[model samples]
Target: MKQTIPGLIAAIMALSSCSQRTTTTNHVKVKENPVNTKVTEQALDKGLFATLKIKNEFKTGEPVKLKFTVYNSTDSVKEFCKWHTPFEPLMSKYLEIKEANGEEAAYQGPMAKRMMPPPASSYQKINPGDSLSVDVDLLKGYAVQKPGRYTLSYTGQGMSGLVVKDSVVFHILP
Candidate 1:
């Protein structure tokens, strides 16, 4: 009888855990809708410019690739890097980043490691009339699937704040 009671208790505990695991309630309140982000053209090709172009419109859980082009007509070579920021502007006010395919996206590392130092930016040098290309993996952790417009920009860490020489607006439809 003692052995049977212990087994029964274990079974009940297991059942309780299983039930709690899938107890997802849809009573969570919804957040306010986001605002539209403005898209502007930067003549980096003419002077110092950066551009982000995707192969196609992105969708939730859809595999995609982004092509970034940095054009520097200046005397010095411009540097560039990539980032996935989802919380800025709270959406509607500006383009924001969100999880894609139900997964968070960003270079996994410490803040110092992920963000480059001023003048020692993420991108390398792009000399006069020179252009640089980078391929971004849309899977394996880094993706945004909220289905909205996003601004992918090249920002350089500067003394004042950040220098955004160029940017592009892309859309992801649900």
Candidate 2:
């Protein structure tokens, strides 16, 4: 019986330690203030990720489509996160719009590298293993525009403690 007592105590100690094991999710923690508050809300949702792609181009007044893929890894889809204008000045500083002939174009409202609030018609959703695409023109509805490379960057936060960022590079040509 004494032998059994030690064995039982050993089993109890092992089981108690197992309870202390913690499950930590693999995600990047955002220590700094978010560029947008919506990022904080989205970071709580699972399976939320954004994919960005940029194409090199050399034409002005042409379409410069920006595509984003929002996907959910879990079965439930949440709309806690929304697209907001980026506050980072660097986000605007990196975009360079030159003429097709290699001349600098006139400065417009916000630079291309900055993030813009989604238009009124903008609503993005993602389901489990599903992704969506967004397209925007380089200089929507413009003419006599310059041709040059354009860079874009977007930041997003997921509810699952995931922060995603994407950068794109495009150019305008004659």
> How far in Å is the alpha carbon of 84 misplaced in model 1?
9.8
Clashes of 1: 12
**Clash count of each predicted structure:** 12, 22
RMSD of 1: 21.0
| Candidate 1 per-residue lDDT over residues 1-174, each given as its tens digit | 989999998766543321101122333432221212222343423244444556546777776565544444444433432232111211111112344332323533223322223223323444444555555534433345557665554433221111334455556779
Model 1 lDDT, residue 5, Cα: 98
lDDT of all the models against the reference? 0.40, 0.41
Position 132, candidate 2: lDDT: 51
Off by over 4 Å in 1: 1-47, 75-110, 113-123, 138-143, 146-167
Candidate 2 lDDT over 1-174, as tens digits, reads 989999998766543321111223333333332223243344334445555555666455556665544544444443323323121221222233444355544434453431233332333444434455555443532232554455555523311122455455666677
TM-score of 2: 0.43
